[model samples]
Target: MSLVSALAIYFIIWWMVLFAILPIGVVTQEEAGEVTPGTESSAPGRPQLLKKALLTTLVAGVLFAGIYWLRVHSGLTLDDLPFKPPSAR
Candidate 1:
């Protein structure tokens, strides 16, 4: 995999993991509308949903970067080697 391919894979994997569970970790309470667990007043009217989304994305991005590094060093990237078409064989 080249740099582009690695980046693509990382983003795909990261977002997949993030959204497979929940795009936003926030949840709505019966009266509060949207709140985190064990919290009250919903943090004084902040954008809880957006905050969760940003946090999830930030964490995913870091994880993706790590995976990209691992993939690049796993000896699977094709950058250092040349390839030939099947017909050339």
Candidate 2:
């Protein structure tokens, strides 16, 4: 892949991994028994966003590496998928 394409793929993968990781290890104010008067109980008591972000970056990097290998070394392409319509094939 070109530099732009590689960067774009990595960016997409990073965002996806971030979303997937966001709900993990969550602690709501209600769950922690520390719901403040003004805030909703459903709000997170300690989001630990920095840690999740770091983890997301690591996971996304590994996933992107696998995808890059499939695209480059394995010569896998969109047309090779089995679900394509007969006309397209």
Candidate 3:
């Protein structure tokens, strides 16, 4: 894949992985018994966003590498999809 296409795919994978990792090891204010007066009880007491972001990057990199390897080494491509383009008819 071209650099731009690869970067775009990686960006998408990183965001998806970030969302997936966001809830891991979370501690809500309610769960920690430290809900502030003005904030929702469900709000995270310690978001640890930096740590989660780092983990997300690592996971996304590995996943992207696997997908890239599959695309290059296994000859997988959009043509393998079940549907066909109108022009192919």
Model number with the top TM-score:
2
Weakest ten-residue segment in model 2 by summed lDDT = 80-89
Model 3: number of backbone collisions: 0
Please write out the lDDT profile of model 3 over residues 1-89, one tens digit for every residue: 99999999999999999999999999999999999999999999999999999999999999999999999889989888788557843
Shift of residue 9 alpha carbon in model 1, Å? 1.6
Question: Candidate 3: which stretches are off by over 4 Å?
Answer: 81-89
Error at 84, model 1, angstroms:
30
- Per residue, candidate 2 scores C-alpha lDDT tens digits across 1-89 of 99999999999999999999999999999999999999999999999999999999999999999999999999999878878456853
Selected candidate, larger lDDT, 1 vs 3:
3
Query: Which residue ranges in model 2 land beyond 4 Å of their true spot?
Result: 84-89
RMSD of 3: 3.0
- Using all chains and alpha carbons, the TM-scores for the candidates as numbered come to 0.44, 0.90, 0.84
- Write the residue-wise lDDT of candidate 1 on 1-87 in tens digits: 687986687678767766754634443353457556677654543446565566667877788777666666665555656876568
Shift of residue 18 alpha carbon in model 1, Å: 2.6
